[model samples]
Target: MAATVEYDVMMAPEEPERSEEEREREAETCKEKGNVFYAQKDYNEAYNYYTKAIDWSQKNASYYGNRAATLMMLAKYREALEDAQQSVRLDDTFVKGHHREGKCHLLLGNAMAATRCFQKVVELETKNEQARKELKNAAAVLEYERIAEVDFEKRDFRKVVFCMDRALELAPACHRFKILKAECLALLGRYPDAQSVASDILRMDSTNADALYVRGLCLYYEDCIEKAVQFFVQALKMAPDHQKARLACRNAKALKAKKEEGNQAFKDGNFELAHRLYSEALNIDPNNIKTNAKLYCNRGTVNAKLKNVCKAIEDCTNAVKLDETYIKAYLRRAQCYTDTEQYEEAVRDYEKVYQTESTKEHKQLLKNAQLELKKSKRKDYYKILGVDKNASEDEIKKAYRKRALMHHPDRHSGATTEVQKEEEKKFKEVGEAFTILSDPKKKARYDSGQDLDEDGMNMGDFDANNIFKAFFSGPGGFSFEASGPGNFFFQFG
Candidate 1:
């Protein structure tokens, strides 16, 4: 049996088990295949092959290094970083592995880690001037960014701008830094400057939310409210869950819709509805300057129509205060002052309106206010009540009741609808006159010198609005080509 077996295997020694040399050769063969796929830009296939090579020979640092590069192409940065670190650990002299680790750190916003890697790369290979440059850049950018963060938290936008500018100088192509600069500009109310920065960013990445929002603010500051809203809508569309964009869109739409409703209701003589709609618009976004001003002015009109004399005065005053250059607000306030018998104040407001916009209506209002001023200055309350200053209290009371009965709304059923409101106003005036004349102290106070101007009324101030706010492929494991960094840094997987 031995002789037969020897005869069968006589010419061939048993096939020797693969030695370490063969195992390493097989691993290199796999790694070479991975390299070919990588050169072909087939990153997934390259990654698979590289992983296979690692399985075959885990101690081969070149296999792990090559696999890390493949992972970076696939946008698996965190995993890439892990693999790269492992590669460097196994063979501390691997320059490519250190470079990849640095790139991964840079992408993840770990400037300190990135600087350390680059510094080590320079240390390992003294002739690597590119790595040396990267080290300095990372260190400088990290320091400036740290300072910018501190200033930003303090709301010191100027300081933030200063720090961000220094950072941008070091890494001019950083998209995140550009975005931060634009935001700081916006917070400082530098819309035009922010827009310029945002425009540059948009040219690089059109769908960037920070750029879109800053552009919208620019348009809004320019009084292009509708266009601004459209930009915000685009921002929201691009980032569906962006709360800031959502709020901007909602506020803009509500302002537009509510103002339209108020305008229509006012046109239809629905003063109550107009007032409510205007108020709702203001409540929705109290800081929208134009919308806030418009709602105030429009509500003032409604207040006047509904005979809310004091409320009308308050609304119109707020409207004008909010926007000194708003012609309509000044005109509305003038009218309110006239209704409240503040003829001097009315003339002052009308004069401002007349200076900017001269229309037939404004001219008539100016003349009327001037005439009322003359009458108000010499106003006689006892004569207004048809009573002599020396008339007995009984005589004054009887005279007021007679005049009140004649002008009373309830007694004016025969009057046209148009005249009935006027008659009710007259009735109230008659009652007011009666009360003033009947009260000895008030009558004496009025007769002495002053009109009853301060009736324990106070108007609150108007609320103002405060409005305002990557990748490329390249060397190393990461591409810095300025085209677009794929999902590598924030890899989906």
Candidate 2:
């Protein structure tokens, strides 16, 4: 059997060792087949043929570049980047290799590195339109990055978002810009938009710590505190040294603890303790608008319980300013204004609440506040007469006589025109007061806070001269008039 095998081997024409030229020709053939598959959009077959070409001729830059292109088509960006780097290393003067390298770097989110590669391409072929366009795009991304940093430092989050959008248009594969845009959206109180961006990133790379942190930030601002805390914790687990994540996680935990403590204190009727805890919670993270808004509202509730109506209103106003959608804050402030008899302010707050909520309860509260405001705007007859709501008819008459004589326009004839005008106004008010209070029916309606029409029992029917004449003149047409300085005389016709 050994003899037969030796004879067969000897008889078979000796296969010549392949020359370098022959191997190169075979590699070119494989590359042509890869190109054909690529033109057919059969990326898997193209990748297989290109890989074979690289194996056949490992030193060929075109083989590496072709394989890199196929890997990019497969969405294997890191692998493509490695192959692109190898292509450029084999042939530094290859413009296609450098361009592909830049594209890979850009897709990998290394914009600065991509900019360098694109710059190399431009230097190699100054008139290469594709290379020039790519370089411009990369440079634009860097410019937007710089602008975004400045805007973010200035707290111009809207401008930051604009710049991030521009950067994203230039580098759509860049995760860094997406993260920044998501963060800015969260800062602007667009929690859903921010969450959508962060969630998309998480779908692509579940372990992306920055994406997790941004998602947590959106959830935190949306008042999903427990879910936010879980995301923050997971982000911290992934990246222990992430400063923003660390701080956010710490603040979220502290805020939860403080807020819970305040709620407990409030439930226990310890208003002062509750206020203090809520204040501490607010100080924990001023930038956390969503949490801080609730903290302000909680402190305002405590203030209301303590009968600090003005302070409560102030706190609730701050909460509404921080978050306009905070219906509870608006409702609380309206109540505080109502308690303090600030009907105008109460009406405004209630209107805002009703507009946002549109609930029957809110609508009713708004209507009640509007009614109180209308009543407040009306003339206070008792105040004009300097009499109490409980004053007897005799007492009201005495008060009216005293106030009318003091404010009569004739009595102020020697004063300035401005003083006389004011006195005339007061005199009319006093007469109107007497006209309403002297009649039991009118007084009853006024006391009941009824809206008397202009012609019924209001100032429209008031004539100061007629009221004065009726009060002073007797059956013999007796009159009381202002005479010599500060003196009064009576006469009968």
Candidate 3:
């Protein structure tokens, strides 16, 4: 059995108290050490010392504020935010604490929260220039981010540049802004400018993954394929999971291979094969402006070689749509229309080429188009059919039948109903002209320059195909396909 000994409760004397002044003195020593570390840019060490000072004197707002700034420098943004909030909580009138909190939020990528903190700082201290500056910066960053995201989603590279420029003006030191600006410039085909921007970013932060990625894109655009691959490799080294860098590297390598293949094909005079290779490159990167433009222009040339004038015009039109300032597209489209005897459309495209091009060759092209337009308008149908003005009646009938069968609407079914109608009208006109010329009496009258409707053919007899063949195919010998829209000519003609 253990004896229960009664033990007297000994009351301990009150622990020695620290005077507020002594606590403050100890806090000052910690603060001084923090400032030394901060000046040396040892932000983590500075943060530790400043936090120690705050713990020593919980009521000192300045200690908490300084610690928050050090935490921000260390990129411990959430912790810095808490410390700054505590600072302002301890002394709500402290303008510096509010400003520090805003900075922490900004570093944390919480622009709206930063904005609120800055607004509060400005409200409490209207004349705090630093707070006002921070507020303006935060607002600009927020607006820029919003606009850039919207424009990027819309594929509006021009508006992206506008928004990113505003952001750069506000946050000149922001790597994110610089990267976005470079991307916009690349999209706009300002390769040289994009390269310069990317280089500047790399110079400032050599290990920056985004900067390396963007520099790779610029190099790829500039046709420096090998160098571009190196840049992407470096970016991957910095951030192994960078999807954009990996994609860019793969695309650049593919483009280089495709370009080589296309060049060889072009040199071998295999225009169709060359066009196919260029198309493949474009498919790898649809936004590749240079490749797309080149493909359009080259495809137009191939279509022309294949004697597909309308297809050539379509290809050239696509080129121009991809890049409105494509002078080659305008010129090629004009040539296609001219070859097809579409003089009015040719004139419009020629005018566009003239507006964009300053070369002497382009001036000559414009002059040639104008002259051709005038000549085409004056071509006579009778001269094109190659019949004598005074052939015998039997000979005239023979010639009319031969010409009608040769230029018959059944040969060109793809023409529109209007075109078929025009061809029929032309055929009737030729028949009537032959009837008048073939008759000895009527021929004599016509020879004397007298107006005579000798055939007496009614409007119903003058079919549309005759008119269209005489008007369009008369001079240029134009023809339509046999299986397309205007195949109604088989029933009527």
Candidate 4:
């Protein structure tokens, strides 16, 4: 209603260079020409002449009504209503003006207003059966429309339909009533019926934003979110400030676009890009609970892809909190747990997913979790180092030195590519064992159901030269004696 333009006196009259009588004569001439054009079926030209006549003499009630009739022919009901009301305001005795105003009100779906206008027309022209009949019909529609509005405000959409049915019976061709009925049906989850009504309205006026919005809602309810967004966008194009359409369009377009970008990036092995895009989707509608849950689940996948096991578990946990029934959340969280070696937690998650979806893949994942749990429970560091648990510090050191040298990358400098890769893996394993055995605190932690490779100094701790130094050193270690050899020469003393 606020969007309806106020058509106040639209024209400004020129200065009175001529006499008042002469101006009235000029106005009459314009009005005659407007009548000529109206008879010729040139409503646009007729409207221009009427406008000029009104500009010449603002007090001509007939000029206002004539222009209003022309506006009606052009289907500008709101403007016609304004002009007709203006004509009646200027001359209360104008029966044709009242009749035109009532027709405008009827077309605008203001039943009570149409009733009042027709009532006035009947009072001005007794024995007018047309006015009598229209007034009675408008009154019935007004009553039904009142109840429908009250039901709508109460959120009683079924009763809203009940009232609208009677109103439409009295005024079946009213698009406003039909559109209202469609909206009520959509609220009641009758999407197909709502779309049917909207389609009917569109057949009458394809540019009806309300009809477009109803169609969009039907699509949204049917789970065609992307297609629904197009309808919402079209409605918004016509009525930019339609709040519901704007919000729906924004949510659908943003979510779908970001998800598509993320999927493509994930396919192309651009994990960082995928992560960023999914994050943007979450930001678009943070308060959309179900959608946010899905976004969190997808972002968890991205984190898992990027090797962020802890972050992935956290994201999936957040998703589960939003929607506990989300199977993918449990599945993704379990995978992260398995990757991080928290196999018991992984087993619980896989079981959660398997309970709902017991397919071969789910069963295989559960089996994988069970095997990993066993592996995690009994890792043998001493065995990997080729030493007994009771080995002394010196004995452990000698064993580690031998193992590390055998698997070191430099020790296999001329080896094949596959051999070098295998050596690197062995070197990492040996280094992890050495790190655990070398640190008493870490060794105690490992013995107490917790072991971590992150605690180790790893490959950065020693280069080939350092390994050679360790190799050449005595039990008490070696000191360099520069006087025993040439300048800067290494010596074991």
> Once superposed on the true structure, which residue ranges of model 4 sit more than 4 Å away at CA?
1-16, 146-176, 187-216, 225-493
Q: Over 4 Å off in model 3, which ranges? A: 1-98, 104-151, 154-172, 190-197, 219-227, 381-383, 386-493
- Which sequence of candidate numbers ranks them by TM-score, best first? 2, 3, 1, 4
lDDT of each: 0.76, 0.87, 0.76, 0.82
Clashing residue pairs in candidate 4 (N, C-alpha, C atoms within 3 angstroms): none
Which candidate tops TM-score? 2
Per-residue accuracy of model 4 over 1-493 as CA lDDT, tens digit each? 5787877786888765988898899899999999999999999999999999998899999999999999999988889889999999999999989998988887677878898889898888898888898888787788788888898889898998988887777656578889889988977768789999999888878999999999987776554777888899899998999987888787777777887898899889898998998898888755455666887888899898888888999999999997788998998899788778799999999998889899999999999898778656765778888998788889878888788767766657678989988988777777667767777887776665543555554434555444445555776554443443322234446
Error of 1 at 173 (Å): 4.4
Instruction: At residue 449, give the lDDT of candidate 3.
Output: 44
Off by over 4 Å in 1: 1-174, 177-191, 220-226, 354-375, 378-493
TM-score of each: 0.48, 0.80, 0.56, 0.41
Give the lDDT of residue 313 in candidate 3. 86
Residue 441 of candidate 2: its Cα lDDT? 81
Locate the minimum summed-lDDT window of 10 residues in model 4: 480-489
Ranking by lDDT: 2, 4, 3, 1
Tell me the number of clashing residue pairs for each predicted model. 8, 0, 22, 0
Clashing pairs in 2: none
Model 2 lDDT per residue over 395-482, tens place: 9988987898898776677799899889989988898889888999877777666766632554676688788888877565548766
- TM-score of candidate 3 against the unseen true structure: 0.56
